[model samples]
Target: MGEDIGLWGVPLAIIGGAIRVSTPFLFVSLGECLTERSGRINLGLEGTLVFGAMSAYAIAYETGSPWLGVLAAMIAGTIFGLLHGWICSLPKVNDIAIGIALMLFGMGLAFFFGKSFIQPVAPDLPAISFGFWSDYPQVQAALKVNILFLIGIAASLGLWWMLRNTKIGLRIRVVGDSTDAARAMGLRPNVVKLLSTAAGGAFAGVGGAYLSLYYPGSWNEGISSGQGLMAVALVIFARWNPIYCFWAALLFGGAGALGPALQSVGVTQGYYLFYAAPYVLTLVVMIFTSSAAKTMTGAPAELSITK
Candidate 1:
């Protein structure tokens, strides 16, 4: 470890850390992008993310299968989305308020039910090594990429493509841009938003799976560190573009890795401050994207926040 830390430490750690940390951001933002495109905001996704982590870890511990745990998390997230959607569809309900309530509820439930999983050993997901091409052990370890990360990349690209070309994507965009137009076209805006929100929740659940089943590789209440909420801001910064979300995830991941990367390079002092890198980046993004006119340039017309 000491030998590897001399000159290559920060870069190597950043590379490895970026891959590990960016994954959840990638997933959550993508999920939020999908939901927002349908004109609903599921702030409850934070709760969905936490609940998914608890469910994933617990199920993985009990079933001895990490993938099964991931599936369970997805299902749980979908349920949360369904509930949020149902409530939001009712007259005069606030999606933002509903999201906050669900976030607290999910956190409470995760802490209550995840007690047994605190000490249990859950299975880990697989990784593909690109480090074999290198001779160093640390290099090999650092270059070992989690399969889920790769899947996130694929999902980002696929989502971007679908939004530009697919029929389902067109419907979602239409509902987002104008409810009246959708109704005129004989499309059900509520149904579209509901299903999109559910899909968003499922993606967040997979992100939770990546948390426990891969990096950090354990079940814990504080594992998410507000990634789900931060993702909402990330989606905004990316202008609700799925392709941009991918790049934004990478940038956030690199910020998150800054502290550890510096520590690895013998910069032990104030290392803890680096953990705030992502949050700092988030603040900066929000500031630059904010407008004095109280307008969101790229936002969908039907979104309550934009109105």
Candidate 2:
């Protein structure tokens, strides 16, 4: 009975970890998909994520509502996106360099504003329960999922549908494929890129909010651990598809949980290696997905990196 219980617990723990950890990746990767689809990249998303976390934490602490914190984070993210879009649209300013600069700026801003908010407890988000049918403790633990995970799934499906079936989606793809063609077709490529980048920033910001308000529930200097950057890599591995982003996020989440799960099971040696698992997996995925021949065909033509 004990062995059966232990064996069953592993899968359940992995599921719970997926729900707990994947929410941010889902938001950021989906957002990055939108930006990349419009032939632009926003490396500043790291900054956006951190700033969003800080802004969400502050607002939620002040307003006494976690939802309001999320709203504020979105607004802040939108503003950051707009700023990034406006700046990147300029002549001779490399988008990648601009992204890096904006990341530094955003991080600075977050640190400055978050200085006074070190210890306040923000309102917590409510978790959804689906454990009613599970009599086993392991089953109940696994079935307890975050509401954001469901939201992320719905958002991915909605984005996938819109990108494949909607007119705006078509326009965005066209712009990403060839700016010259977009201009010839009487579509403003710059406008499309700007809007998409802003939207991406908003998503990244919300991802940040999820980290501070939901998962970790606190703010500090090192709150984000490269999840924003990894989401960018994940987007490529996901082939710029929102639905794939959902699956990729869950996979990364599981990889992240592996270390802690091992620790929980009384296996603590090589903890550092386990901590590196997600990044290692990300690197492996990127190497496989970003082959010279494959990316030339798969990547949007107007995109500067893949080109």
Candidate 3:
């Protein structure tokens, strides 16, 4: 009976873990998708994410409101995005280089200021119970869903619809395809890229907030664990589609949860190696999808990686 329960527990744990782990990925990838759709890449989102986490944690601790912390994170992310966009718009500036620099800068700021927040307790985001009908404690715990995850799902659908139907989406698509064409059509490419990057940063910031204010709920320097960087690969795997990003995030999340899920079932041999599953999957996806011979399918025409 115990073995049977363990077997059943494994799948349930993975399912629950996927939902919990995927929230940040979902937000970051969705943000990256939006930024790329406008023909700009902001690699500095890693920094933005860390800084946002710090900011969210600090604010939540001080204000006693997790929602305010989220708002602060968004604002901070927007500022970082604006800075990245502005710098990239200058003559002879490289967007990729700017992104890397900003990544370092953001992380530095986060570490320096976040030191004080390490020991403080902050208000956590609330979770909605979806397992009310279940009598099992494990099931109930597994089904306790965060509001941010649900919001991410809605954002995915909304982003997909906007990209397919709206005028702003049309502009983003046009800009991403060709700056020359965008200029010919009387659109300001720089402005579009600027706003898109800012928006993307905002999304990433929210992802960071989800990290410290919810799952793994704490303010810490290492909380991100390179998830922000991995989100870039996720965008590639999703082919810049917001809907696909949602699924891809969940896949990555499930992979991340594999180790813990197995451990719970008494499979401890090589347990630590399971933690590498997400990274391994990232590398595999990159290897198969990347090619020097041709542009990736669905990649933005003007994207630096594609070009």
- Record all residue pairs in model 2 with backbone atoms less than 3 Å apart, i.e. clashing: none
- What lDDT score is found at residue 70 in candidate 1? 90
* lDDT (C-alpha, whole model) for all candidates: 0.90, 0.85, 0.93
Cα error, candidate 1, residue 189 (Å): 0.5
Worst 10-residue lDDT window, candidate 1: 1-10
TM-score of predicted model 1? 0.97
TM-score of each: 0.97, 0.95, 0.97
Candidate 1 per-residue lDDT, tens place, 51-154, comes to 99999999999999989999999999999888888899999999999999998998899999998889989999999999999888768877899999999999
Residue pairs with backbone atoms closer than 3 Å in model 1 (clashes): none
Model 3 gets an lDDT of 0.93
Cα lDDT of candidate 1 equals 0.90
